[model samples]
Every structure is written in structure tokens, then in C-alpha cells.
Target chain A: MTDRPTIQRILTGISGFDDIAVGGLPASRSTLVSGTTGSGKTLFALEFLARGISGFDQPGVFITFDERPGDLRVNARSLGFDIARWEAEGRWMFVDASLEAGEQTPTVGTYDLGALTARIAHAVRQIGARRVSLDSLGSVFTRFADQDLVRRELYRLAGMLDSLEITSVITTERDADYNGVTRQGVEEFVFDNVVILRHVIRGERRHRTVEIVKFRGATHRTGEWLFTIDPEDGLVVIPVAFLAPRDRASSERVSTGNTELDAMVGGGVFRDAVVLLIGSHGGGKTLAALQFADAAYRAGERCLFHAFDETRGQLGRNAAGWGLDLDVMEASGLLRVAATYSEVASVEDHFLRIRRDIADFAPARLVIDGISALERRATPRTLLDFVIALGGVVREREITTLFTSAPTARGTSPIMEIAGITDVTLVLRHIEGPGTVRRAIAVMQTRGSAHDRAIREVAIDDTGMHVGDPYPGILRLLPDAPVPPSDREE
Target chain B: MEDQPPAALTPMATYAFRMYVAGRSRRSQAAEENLRALCDFYLPGCHEIEIVDATEQPALAEEERILATPIVIRKSPLPGYRVIGDLSDRSRAAFLLGLPDSGRPSPEGQRL
Candidate 1:
């Protein structure tokens, strides 16, 4: 049992998004996605369908309960998603029941959803679809008086979809404030996966985020991820960067080219443990992660690190000056560096892919350099589970986990739960001390063990992660939420 | 919070009237009686009357630019002609909106 740790495999066919989803959606079963109108549920489902056909070569169909086939096709076409064209090509089938589908037909009494459910099944089989979407089922309960009817139809509907071997997304209209509690209680339990799309109002601005609440057969990152739907680009996701897992840090404990850095991390980080290095932007989080990797490699230890917030090419090119030759390490299998953009993934995909890498090489040390990236793809809860599960692996297999967490400068600290639940929560803050301000490190909390709690100043020169007593002029790294671009709007 | 007077009246310009007052204040009752007599005397079938009280429709009062004990702003439906006072003189009220009053205000005024 002391053998190497293994990575889990899951694939979701969407591009850019899959990058944030980690590798991709896990293969097989169903995932529930609940959101309000215009929150991009159908778009997300369509993108999944498009990817299923184009990337995975799986024929899929989309059955709409709200919009008509003609309208759905036209809407999809405007976004370069020509559903009708795909239908003609035999890759997708678009089915819309305008009257029964849309709630436009108001009634004083209840309605029947059996015909609609049967129609969805028939549509799924008609096109030989391996993937399908209900588009919506909020109005499904409009007919059934007893809540059990809604539960039963959803269960049978999901069962039918599963029997067809379809990895599908069933979207429902959910409240803006998501509290992990589901309204369609039984339906959520029936599905193998649940993704909650939430529109959050931070300060005065509204942000759309997606979180995977439950993935029964697999481990998923459950965190709120900021997402956007561009007419031309579809759903674009950007994940906050934080400590990454799956990639191990070097235990060689190389000096932070800067001597002070060595003392800050206690003669460098220990081997095979989850070390969370946190700070604000430009607070040297990335540089610190790099310095440790460089130190270990120079010490003749194999280092495998994957940075999700950046690309492999960009990271290598940027840090070339520090005598950190990522290109060489990658070729030698001594350093496996990969940079992934969150817009390319949902957190579930991210966890799955990282799980994959962890399995493949079974590195003695794995570092998810910035965990914030996965937060964009998952709900906070799923992200927590993903991290807990990751910690379990790190402890059981003895793989050192070192990653960076960059905090925001706002009252709302969304990443707190994730940071709090981690094994080690360190803060690289810029604080004012002795009349001057500079970078500092505070050991917030490290469970199961005790370490330095007092904060001390840290500096970076030619090397990285230097520690010293308090400095007067430098600023303290205050926690804040990263603002989105749309926030600039008046 | 007092009621406003009947606004100016005109053939082209609307006999726009707003009954502004406090929560059934004394001034409000006086304004209401004055407006009825004034409207009954002249300028018929060419006015828009809106009854507003600060204790009730405060938003409307602000929008109509009412800010005194009893004020009325009768405006020309065509351009920028207005009057803010009691509509006791039929000719003066009509003249404020650049119109000559023919007779008493019409209960069924044509909507502009």
C-alpha cells in the first residue's frame, strides 16, 4: 500500500473550459447543472454537446423544454453553433416542444410532464445520441400536484438517459443564492453529478459562477467559479489561482537563491506534505513556488510541478532568468511542468486531470502551484471535497504537496474555506512594521502539528522567499477578492 | 404640506392641473375648492388634472417640481410656456401658457 499515488481520469469535451475543469468532465454518468434564466445553462449544455461531437466524436442531441427547435437553432447559429447544420450532418439533433416545453401556456390547474419526458427519451433515441440535455425542468413540476411526481419523473428520466450511455447535463432554474441545499432534493440524489450555477452579487457587481455540488462516482472540486457567456466565445471561465495539487514540490530543499527565503520556509519546505504558500498579487507567490522547485532541482531531486494559472511555455519563458531550466527538467522527466488556463476547465475537470497526472507518475511530491484556478470550475463545497480528498492522498501516499495561494484585497474572502481546510495555511502579507512596510510570512494555522505563528518580513532578490524581522516601509499583504473586468463598468 | 393651485390653461397648451396638498391639510381643502371654482369659471375641456398629496404621492410632487405650500405648474403642450399660481384669473392663467381662455375647464378634457 506504500506504493505511488495514482491520478484519476475524467474527460469533458469542451475546450478552454476543460482546462479549468482540470483535464475534462469525468467519463460516463450524469451531472446536474442548476441555474436561473440566461445564466448560460443551455449554452453550457450546447457547448458540452458540441464538444462531445467535435472533440470526443460522440453523437449527441439537445432536447429543449423552453425554446422551439427553429429558435434554438437560430440562437445557436448566431454563436457559431449551427444546431441545424450539425443535425443535417448527423452529429446533433435539436428537439423543442414549444407548447408543452415553454411555460407560455398558463393554466389555473396542474399539467402533465409524462408526454414531455417520453418525448425527450424518444428524441434521445431518434438521433442515436450519446449525450442530451433536458434544457430545463422547472416547469416540469407545473403539472404534477404531488412533489413526488416531479421526483419520480426526474428519476426515470435520468435512468433512461443513463441506460443510453449518455453523459448529459440537466439544467434547472435555481435561486441566486446557492447554499449547497437543493430544491429538487430527490432529483439531485438520483443523478450521478450536480453542478450549481450561481449569480453572485459582490459589492455592487453581479458575477456568474458554476459549482459542482455532487459527483457520486468521482471526486470533484466544489467551488464557485467566475464564468461569463460571450456571444462569440460562448461560456468563458477564469479561475482564481491558489495552491495546486497533483504536482509535487522538490524536497531537496534548495536555498531560495535568496538566503533569507531558506529561513522563512524552515530550511525550505518538508518533503511529502501539503504546504500552502499564500500572498496577494505580486506578493511573490509564484516566485516562491518557483524558487522551491529550482532549489530542489539544483539539489539533484526530481521536481514535477504543474501551474494551472499559466501555460507551460509562458512559465518556462518567464522564469528562464533565475537559472530555472524548466525545458530541460521536462525532457528529463525530472520536472513535469504544465500551465493550464481556467477558462479551459471547470473544477471537476481540473481535479480529474490532476488526479490523472498523480496516478501516471506517482511522484514523491506533487504541487498544484495555485489552487485558485480550480475554484473557477467548481463550487466551494466540491472544491473542499476535492482538497480533502487530495490531502488524504498526500497523507496516505506520503507525496509532498506544495502550492501557492494569492489572496484578494477585499472584505469578502471567498477562498477562506479552502485555505482554512488545508493542512498548512501561511500568509505572505505586506504589513507595516516598525514604521516601515515590507513583505512578511505568518503561519496562520497548521493542523496536526505546530509551527511558527509570529509573522516576519520576507524579501526576494536574485533568489526567492527571503525571511527577516519586520521591515518598516513595505506594505502588508491584505486579503481581498479579485475583481472582474466587468466591474469597471459604471 | 399644502395643496397646489389649479395650473394655467390654454387651447394649444394643456390646462395641465395638479392638486398638490398635505395629508388632508387645511390649505389642501382651500386649494381644492379654489381649483373647482376656477375650473368651473373658465378653460373647459383642455386640462390634465392630477391630485397629489405629499403624505401619499410624494414622488409625483417632486417630479412636477412642487416645492412650496401651494404651487401649480401649468405647461404648454407645445413648447416651454408655464405658470405657477392660483388659477383665479381665467385670462392670466391662459396668458401664462400663451393662450386665450374661451371658457371654463372641461371635465372631459382631451388628452394630449
Candidate 2:
């Protein structure tokens, strides 16, 4: 670590926010949070104070200029913040500067917001507050006619807060999503740090992101990071790509649930490996996933199976056809099959739900069947982010995960992008013979270990998947024609 | 223009006004001076002025939702109206506070 005098920070305690903020807002300094309407600017401002009071025992004063204290109190209840109780406990205070409905105050000549500044100082002193939030300063700008005067008074207010050694969040509104920093175009210049929240409609879905524009003598992660407003947890930023790679790579092997597939992958896959199963509709991807889950149950370990392409009933019927009793495994508490339509929610919500399930069940193995079905609901970039984030979660817990996807028509499939992050990849395809369409399987990559490099025929009977002898002269027929050197020896 | 006041005002009606200020600042003093002059010229003996220093009485200012300093609230004579800023423009301030117009014919031929 450099011995430079880095600016001190106060942890906001917002989920996944501190990771990107490099700690939190600069200590005892004001930061501007600007956003468009309904872009969660108020929520960010409220959470900054709520979390400070609850998580850090820091009292705060909320100076609301647009919303009343009662509305804020009621709205905060949905996010598990008891503002009334905090008020009763002398930890939270509100300086109600919100204008009454239809009650306009006409200006005569010249004035200053000294009354607001005095009330704010009084509230801060009453509660001994160390944190203050002035939400949506745009209302003040709209209330007054002179922009320069308002800007000057707000600048003085910020200076006073600094002298009080109070860390503050002053929110402002932006007219458009990607315009200047604020609606007034001067609010950002008054503060040392600035954060912007954006809500963009992409492909008929709302994608929320937060970015740290500048920190002024401080360091922070630069970019737009995805976030979702959870009712129970408030605004949760999804810092997926920023997660540090897991340092400990487990070398112990775990079975792939199929004897032939295990032999093909040099005995088995690593214990904490993320495996990708790529195939067509009828190429036995679901069967491999089911067998993998069954093997985990047989080993007395818990498994979570999430299905997007099939319903639970259909999956149960398919498992019965393969002579595996899914109900019995579920009854034994070793297997859980959760099936849902991918279009029911955004990919980020699905990710949060899966994360919640993993935390609740603590499974040792996970199987996500038909991730490509989710691709229909999200853009390729979001889908790749989902996979990367999911990879980070499973690998952190050392839970072996298997993700199945149907091959895309184009050369650059979303699955191909995911393959780069997965520890193992298995490709299945239907090879056309002279009179019959036969299935073949190939182990494309195994991160640490390797074994057979042959195109082997795979057959499925009433019993289950069965691996047969190697299929010769099949390299040229495959798409992309990736001819392995071992085929020459044969 | 007729110099007659609007029929709504009665000579016996007492007008009550409360002004919020920030201590003895220059703007607050200017507002006080302008307000006294306006009241003396319009409703001389019928006006009651109560001055509140918001810096010393923040809770009262908060209760009144006072954001800017040197604001005057017309408390009585029904229908309360709030006017912000230091009241230097006596004619406009008189009109906004619903005071009886001064019998002075000026620009725009309107009674001040």
C-alpha cells in the first residue's frame, strides 16, 4: 500500500456499493447524487442515512425539500427501515422544507435560504447528527426564480456542513438520463464527489445502473454497474465483474454422475468447477443435468436444480421415463427442482432469487438447465453478466455448478462467451450417418486435467445415457471443424 | 384611475402580519424598513407587525416551513398569503399582501 494520505471514507453499508465506492463516501464531506425522475435518487439518499444510523450507529438529519417526512417514513417502511422508531430513539431527524400542496410563496425582490440553513443546523445539533441528506435540491431550484442565488446559498450550506465535520449526501434531479450532471448544470460543481443513478429502458425492460462520476482527490471504480431495487433490501448494486477471482482452486475430483463421461474428463471434474453443457434440443443436455443431480443425491449431498425450459411436472415425468425418481430425491431433502418461466422477471431479479436460494439451501451442487431460454429475455451482454456473476457466487462457496444451453445459430453464441469463464465445457452434437442420425459427445476443455480426445458416439436407452466406441472421420462434419491432433493417431 | 380602495376593506378591520428574518442581517433590516413604510402609508394604525428572528427561533421557522429569509405572512384579514425575500418593492409588495391600495396614481395608471 502506498503511504500517500488517502482520503478517509465512511462505509455506506449498501449491499455491493462499498465494493465499487472503494469504501464509501469521503468522510465528513458532501457528495452529490444526481439522477433522473424515478431513477432511485431519493432511495439512494434515504439509504445513505438509514444504513448509517442502523449499521454504523451514526445519527443523521434528512432535509427533504420535495417529499414530506410522513411520505418518506411510509415509503421507507417497505425497505425494512423504521424511520419513526429511529426518530423516537433520537437517531434520525427530518427538517421538513417541503412546500405545502398548492401553497406558493411568491418572491418580492431578493432573499437567501438562511432560514433553511438555520433549521438544518438546529436539527443536526438536536440529534448530534454526523450525517445529513438534502434530497432533490431541484425542488429548491424550481421554487426560486434566481438560479445563481440558489447555487450560491447551497454552496454556503455545503461549506457549513464541512465545517461541522458532517458527511452528507445532497441529491439533485437530472432532466434526462444522459445529459449534464444535473438539471441546473451547476449543482455538481459545488460538491467534491458526485454519483449518478440511471434508469434506462432497454428492450422493453428497465435496467438501473449507478456510476461514480468523480471523487475529487479520491479513487473509485469507474463505470456503470448494474443494480436492482429490492423491496426487502432496498437498492442492491450487482458488482459482478469486480469480484476478485477466487484464489483457492480445489483439485479434488467429483464425479460427473456418468461413468463414461467421468473417464472422458480424466476421472472427474474438479470439486469447485463450473461446467457448461452445450447441445441442441435433442442432444441429451437435460439428461446429463438430471444425472448430475442424481449423482449428488446418491452421494448424500444436496443439489439445487433450476429449470427454465421445462415445468416441474414435465421434468418429473422426464426423470421418471429415465427410471430416476425425482420425487423420492426431493422427499429425501437431497434434491430441489425449481422451475420458472424466464420471462417472468428481469435477469437481475432471477440472479438475486437464485442467490437467495443458494443462501437458504446451501447446496453442494447446482444445475441450471437451459440458460439460453433466459437469453430470449435479456440482451447478450446482460446474459454474459448473469453467467459471470453466477460463476462468482458458486466458486466463492466451492459449489460445483453445471449450466446447460442450446447452441445458437450464429458463430458467436452467448454460450461461447460463457465458455471462456467456465472451468469445463462439454459439447454434444447430432452426427449424420449414412442412414441414421447418431449422437456424439466431446470434452472440449477441462481446466486442470485432461484425458481422452476422441469423438465418441453416445446412445440413450430406457435405462439412461450410454457411451459407445469412438466415432471416426467425424471431425470434418462438425461445425467450425476443430480437428484435434489425437484423431490423426487413430 | 379611481382612488377608491376595494370594497372588501373596512376601516375597523385589523391586519395582522408576521415576518420571519435571520437576525439583524442587512436584508432583514431592509425588509423591516420597507414593511414599516408600506404599512404606515397604507393601513397606518390598523396593522400589527410581529417580527421573528429565525436564527434564534428555528423551530418556529420550521413550523412555518420557512426556507428563505425575510418572508412576510399575512396572518389576519382572512386568506393567508406568503411573500418571500426582502420587501423592497413597496407597490408590488402592497399588491401581493392584499393591502388597501395607496391613493397614488403612477405608471400603468394603477392605484398603488
Candidate 3:
């Protein structure tokens, strides 16, 4: 390992902190932070160490003389750090030496900062820590009397961290006014970086401000950055450039398999687009997704189909019966069917199982039969998140995906509202007329393209789903006007 | 009491719940009624029964997690249990409840 700091990602697991630090603390070097009591000194250290464990997958050693690790763990949940659990996970090591209340005078190396540093080094070797911290170096100094010795120990410890090439954050309690002046102002000169966190009561509001005093490499805003400690999000560091959130998606669409569905769409669903086919029961919403998969398979594009509502064999047979050519397709390795249920398979586990398939099979088309299938165990929001994340995969690999949803009960608003994210929305309905039930198809809306708004009767026979005529459907309910059938000549 | 998380107190068994169904007029209403009937007649005691009249309390179904009338749910017995279907079918209500193998089977021999 080199003695110099590496150009590495800071890996602060704290959600907002990494972004605020513009991706994280400088690796392979120590940063000194000094603050008074209740000024959020310990919180910053805890956040750094805990986040290193969870986010960067780094092990951590916290050397302390102030309080028991138990107290720290309990206190940390409010800051979103389960210190004890991290210790249990073997990612955290606590070196503790507590003082009994009212203990008497001691000076000059009463606390072993050097021995604690060795233990921290040992834990780092054990857990392979890329980061470490010493809670309140001043605590050790509190009991020691030799100023020269303290200075030497402090210099040696910071140099050791630098030599080992490990990123470190060492906290020191300032004497109320020494936010700028360190103990001899010596620790500030020795450490590679110095960050000061202070509490400022401005006008009636108690505010927290963080300022990076010195970092060896790269520049940061000179003005103090404002922040808050929320119970859920932990330490939230406000980024200087956060007003413009990133727009992660480009306009796109995917295929629905059926030509009528395609005609309902402009040509095909946009690449990397998430399309939702929603319809009432027997309205062939699931069939519509299958129709898309079949067309993709026929066109030499492999498709991965996850049928949560039906069996894989049964789905294949059904498609074959409906003239979608499943047998030849599956034999040709153009189609993969996974008939899974959320009961036996958890939503996340199921996603994990198919994550490889999405990566390995790299299908030109992917169908989650109905995203609603996973929405049982997976909430609509989570399901939407998964779809959105998967959309990135589609964008990277240039693939299309189709999701089916049982229309939100007959009259309730659409349950599967994947519409907002789709390049196209196809609506299916079973319109009962002339003592006969007819499957109807309509292009409700297609973003960025002109689509047919006419409601047409849809059918699936020995051939496939056929869209022919506009019927007096949800789009047409006026009396004295007759709607045409799919097979009828107008 | 099986030594689980506090949140686990939220009902683990969403089955055997009740659905209040009165009648069906519109497609939404019919879907809700069909769902309720399917859940009730299929799941039986696994679900509790509560059929209210829309005519009596037309405003009852309004302003809920649901907007339409003829909605149904498993009474407030379990934590985090949901209210679903203004008027749905037996298949969905049955599947939602995770009814026993003895309960309604799909006409196509499909067990949801």
C-alpha cells in the first residue's frame, strides 16, 4: 500500500452524507474534527464508522474512553446506526475503557492512546477495515498531563494512520471556543483533513453547520454546509448542488406482441419502455403480454416470461392452443417461462432469482405477465421501483418489457397505474352486446405519437388476437348509434 | 406471541376475512359483489361476513382507500389487513384471502 491517500470512493453509507461529501471522505488518510458537547461531534464519527461498515462494506474499530459501547449503541438507533448489530455482524469493533464516577487525578499517559491505536489497527486487520475512528482524543488527554507527550502520541497516531493508508476520522472535544484552535493546534497540522461541525443558534432556530477546514486533495465549498440529524435518514448533509435532481429515464416504449396491439401502438413499444396492459377479467390482459412475447420469439428475439398467475407448462400449452407457437419457440431457446408464486417465492427473492436471467439471457423482450402478480407481497410502490430499476437494465441492454394488470375492479380507477411511466397504454375490455361477449381493444394514449382512439372488438382464436371493428364500448355509449363487430363489413 | 417483530402483530393470516356486500348494479358494483361472494362462499369461516346496504349508507363506500360503492374487507380484526374490491369476483377475493385447498377452485382447475 502506498503512503499517499488513494483516489477512492468515500462510500459513506449514510444516504445523504456521501452526496454532501461529494462521494465520501478521502480514503487512506485521517480527518480530524473538533467540537464541544452537544455539538454533534460523536454523531458525525458514529455516522462515518457505521456507514463505512454497511455502505462501503468496510470493517471499523472505534476506540473510546468515554462510555460503554452499549450506551453508544442504544443512543445510535436515533441516528440510524445499530452499532451493536454492526458489532454483531463482525463489522464493528469497540475498544472501551470506562472510568468509574468520581475517579481521582491522573496525568501524562494515564489513558493508552497508543495501545488503543494498536487495538484499532488489529481490528482493522481482522475486519479488513478501510476506515477507523478514535472517539474524543481529548478524553485520553483529559487524564494525561504531559503536553509534549500528548503531542508526540497524537502525531505518531495520525502518521500511523497515514502510513497504513487507511481513512480515519478522529473526534476531539474542543474547549468551547477552540473550534479553530486545536490542542496546541498541533492535531490540526498533523491530520490530513480537518472538519469542524458546530451548532449555531441563529435568530430563534438552533442550526447545525458543517465546514471542511482542510483536505489534502480536491476543493470543497468554503461556506459551511447546513445539515440535520433525522431519526430515519440519519445524518443528512445538504448538497450544494441538489436543486436539479437527475432525470434517469428517457422517453421509450416496448412491444405488446399482437399486431392489433402494435397498430393500437404506433409501430412497437419504445426500447427500454415499461408498458402496462390493464383489463377486466377474460379481457385477455395476460394474453396480451403473452402475445407480445410470442411475437418477439417469432421475430428471433428471446423472451423471459414470468407467469405468477399461471403455470409455465400451462401457459405454454395455452399459447400453443391459441396459435401463438410456444412449443417450437421453447425448443428453439427463444422463450423461457418461470411460473412462480409470491407465496413460495418472496418478491425480492424472486427478483433476485431473475436478476441473473435478465443479465444472462439478455432478452430483447421481457414480460412480467402482470406486475400486479408481484404486487401482492410487493406493494405497488415497490413493484414500481423494481420496474423502474429494471427499466435501466432494458435501457442498457436495449430490451422491451410488458406487464399485465387485472383492471382495478370494474369501476375503481386503474389499479396498475404503470401508465405514467409507459410510452403507451393499451386498455382491454369485455363488452357484452347482442347477448354475446366480445373482447375489445383500444389505445387509450401513446405518448409522443398519434394513435387510434377508436374502440375495436378484439378476438383470439385458432390464429391469435384479432382487432377488427370499433364497437359501442366504454368509448361509445350513445344511444341510436350502432357499433360494428370484428368480422362484420361496415 | 411467536416471538416476532412488533410489526408482525399485523395480521399474518389475511384469509378468512369478511366482506360487506349488498348488491350489484354497475360493472364496478358487480365486480365487488362477485369478489365478496366468492370470498365468502369459498373461504367460509376463514373470513368473517359483513354485508352492508349501499342504499342505507351510500356515502359509506365513498372516501375510503376505495372510491366506488359495494366495497368489501376483512373486518378490523387483524393489523394491516386491507380493504379491497368495491365489487369483485370469487377468484380474486379467494386469492386475496389465501383460502384453503378445500375452497373454491377456478373453473379451469387453476388454484390462485
Candidate 4:
């Protein structure tokens, strides 16, 4: 490690991003930012320069080949960044080199960015800038038919900025392939770092994700990070630490609210353990989990309940039927309820919301009313990662949490496979008796302790939930109920 | 840098020229003189010339899309035209300036 050269970094000032980048961007080198149109590429580049001047006191220059400087100033102003003031203060410079549409100019045999180079050098010297950005040089590539010339000129420009010791960022358009990081493919070769931004529309929602494709000479987080562009905060890269394992383990056990259920799981779940309640609709999963949160709150411990499947008013009304006044609990500040429709936010954004609520409320116990709603919004693979990440974040704070999930339509409980990750996995399902159906609960696995293997009958009333003794007779149980007969074959 | 009002501002004869230069360099002086001589001969006293010294106003280069020094832009008369290098060559300058060669003959017209 001592032999490795020291890698100085420049802070991007984006919240949660520096933690993943380990300490902001690598210093004094070119970084290529590739994204599709309207993916907030220009806004990102401008924000970096703007924050560098305002937050880090690093003067900068912005050379745009796509937008006029005046228009850029107006746009920045609307975003609450006073770029015009920065220009007047000699801390920033905007160079516009955009050619209008249908405007043609004659080009000689071989030419370089001689004029652009002079303007940039002058701006740099004028402000003693430490950062520079070329909004887009994609149009410049069209001026030449030969790719080799474009490549050569790009290297020359890179060398010039290197000599000036300014950390430069060049934005470019992504190719149609979607797999390729940049349009020309030569930019990644020339720059020391490359970041790819993607805007994907999934189920009528737009999701923006960014991935660091290349960071030469250093290790970077390997996963694609979710990012959001707020008018005030610009680009915020979600930290990868959400997946990091935390050294938080406790042998202290807590109650499950239902006496019979607590007795089945040896006494209670261990602190910091994630309990997943797998069930289908009308299986009383949310009611059972809310009983735990209500019990924890009644015991004077703070609890946070995230309702993804139901609104606050609906959840409160449902809980009120069982004499659990969620509204009163929330008013007392002992129970904090966060509600949102799963479809309203991307999975990653929803994860951040949970993390934020956890940080702000500092709850000792938590419940995600319906985790399966998240699984429906994202791919199975992505949902698995999200579950693991959420578990990590919760366990790190030693928050005893319960997650409710419904098995798939095929009666397969996906969360059951990850039983080893959770401290307790209690599966709830319906069993068909002689001409009748009954709800049942089974404690699948309990880490660090023994649990009863017998499946017991469960019943929910207006008063509360009741769990009976284990059934001794032959059980005709299903992991989850089969689909309803609305379209069943005749 | 000089700005001259058009003699008539007509839809056709009222020409508009925007010249991008770099200070008092020989190239800049040559471009200015060549443009003046051509306008004096072709559409004599019927054109407008606006010289922008990029060395003083670097932003003007970007505003005008001036990629090279001693560049000229025929901004008016509907469609515009742009060209690099000092505007010294007669035929090339006329072609870039969109000045039809069927005008009144002059001393410089003989060379073209």
C-alpha cells in the first residue's frame, strides 16, 4: 500500500455519492459523462462546476458546444444556482461554441481546437480555475469524417488540460446500442474516468441510475447507483454502504406481540433480527405484524411502520377495528407511520426513504407492512438485492424489524429461500379443512435458537389476533392459496 | 472594430457582415481591408460591416459561432454564410459574401 501513489480527490459535494466514490472524484484528470438526451447530463456537469465554485472555492470554466452561455445562465438561475453572479465575481466562465441547426461553415483540411484552446487557456488564467467542463464535443466529431482525426484531436485537448492541471469533465451522448457507454467509444479511452447515466422507463415510471464504468488506478463501487436530480440538490448518488455488513449483533430477545406466537419462537425474536412474515391477501399478515409494532410502542419503545400497500388513514382505520389506535400512537410520537404506494417510487428511492425515516425517527422496532409490493415493482433479482440492502441498513442500527410479503401466484414463497439471512421466518397461509378453510401460522426458521415445528391455527377478531395449540390431525396445508376461480377452466 | 450602417437596408442589396478577429493582428487588418474593398467595389455603399475583436470579447466568438480567426458571417439577406481565413481572395470572398459577380465593373472587378 505504501508503494502505491497517493490519489488525491475532488469532492463533488453530492450527498451520499462521496461515500461510494470513497472520497469524491479523482483529481486533476478528465472524466467522461455519457448519457442520453434529457437524462440531466448538462445539468449534472453544470452543478459540478457550480458547487466547486460555491462550496469548494474552486474557480472553474464551462465550455459548452451545445447551449448558449446566456441560456445556460438562465437555466442555472431557475435551478437556484446564481451562475451569472459567479461569472461577475471572476469565479466562473462560460464559453459557448454551439453551432445553430442548418448553419454550415467551411472547414479546412486539418484543424484542431486552436481557437477553443486559446479561449479556455485565457479563462483558466483569468480565474485561476481548478475545474473545467466541456458540455459536449459530440457535434465537433461530425465536422470530421475520419475517426482517427477526432481521436488524435481529443488526445491533444486532453494533454492541454493536463498541463493546466485542471480537473476536466466532458459530456457526450450515448450511442443507440444502449450497451455502449459513449457515442464515439473513443472518449472512454482518452479519459481517466467514465460515468454512464441511464434513464429507464419501467411501468410508466422514469428511473435514473448511474454507474461508474471506469476509474483507472483506483477501486470504485461495482454496482450501478441510483441517482436523483432535485432542483436544489442536483445529482445525488445513493451510497453503496447500504449493502455493507454491520457488526451489530445482540442476544437480547423481544416479543412478537401475540402471546402464542412469541411462545412458538422460543420466547421472542432476538434484537437486530429481521423477521419476514410470508402470507397472501386476507391472511392477516399485516395485522399480526402491526400487533408487534403496537406492543413495542405500548412497552415505551419507538416503532416505525412503513405502509406500502395501504394509506395512513386506511391502516389506521383497519388497526382501529382491533382497538389499536395507530393515529393516537402516531400523535404520541411513539409510533411513526410512513405510507406510500409502491408504484409511486422506484425500488431504490423507496429504500432511501426507509433509511431516511430510520435515521430521523431512530426507532427501536419497525415494520414494513407489505414488502411484496416492492417485489412487484422491480425484477426478482433487483428485489432480492433491495431486500438484502434494507436488511443490512436496519440491522446496522439494531432495529428489530418485520417485513410482510405475499407468496407468488404459483404459491411459491420466494423469501423462504433466504431464511438464513433473516433471524425468524414465519409463514402464514390458508389450509383447507373438511369443507372449510382456516388460517394457520408456522415458524419456519429461527437463527441462534430452537423453534416449535408444529403449525398452529390462527384467528383474527375485532378484539385482536389469537393463536391456538398446534394441530395434531393430518394437515391439508398449502404454502399459499391457489388463484381465484374467476377465469378457471370449466 | 467598426460597424457601418447599410446604405439602403434593402431586402437584397442591404448586406450584413459580422467579422470575428483577434486584436490588431496583420490577419485581422487584412480581413477588414479586404472586406471593405470588396463591398466598396461589388455593392458599393450598400452593405453593413460589424467587426468583433475576439481577443477583447472572447464570448463573442461563441455567440457568433466563430471557430477560427479572421472569420466572416453574412448574417442578413435571408440565409447567411460563414468562411474561415482572412477574406483576401476576390472570388472566394465574393462567393462567401454571396455577392453576385454581375454587378457594375470596377478596378478590383478586373482581377476577379
Task: Report clashes for each candidate as comma-separated counts.
Answer: 93, 1, 23, 0
Model 3: lDDT equals 0.61
Number of clashes found in candidate 3: 23
- Candidate 4 TM-score versus the reference: 0.72
- Candidate 4 iRMSD in angstroms: 3.7
- Among the numbered candidates, top TM-score falls to 2
Residue A134 lDDT (model 2): 93
**In model 2, how large is the Cα lDDT of residue B20?**
94
Q: What C-alpha lDDT does candidate 2 achieve relative to the native structure?
A: 0.86
DockQ of 4: 0.22
Q: Which ranges of candidate 1 are over 4 A from the true structure?
A: A1-10, A14-31, A69-85, A99-123, A140-156, A175-193, A202-205, A211-490, B1-112
* TM-scores, one per candidate: 0.42, 0.87, 0.46, 0.72
Give the per-residue lDDT digits (tens) of candidate 1, residues A261-341. Answer: 445455544554567777776676777677667655666655667787778776776577555677776777666776788
lDDT tens readout by residue for model 4, A273-371: 889888878889879978999878878999999988899888888899888998788888899998999988878778777877888899999899887
Q: Taking the tens digit of each residue's C-alpha lDDT, what string does model 2 give over A424-470?
A: 89988788887999899988788888767888999998788988889
Task: Assign candidate 3 its CAPRI class.
Answer: incorrect
Best candidate, DockQ-wise?
A: 2
lDDT of 4 by residue, B5-98 (tens): 6444343577888877767777678778877877776777778999987767766665555655667788877467776666667556776566
Two-chain DockQ for each candidate model:
0.01, 0.70, 0.00, 0.22
Docking class of 4: incorrect
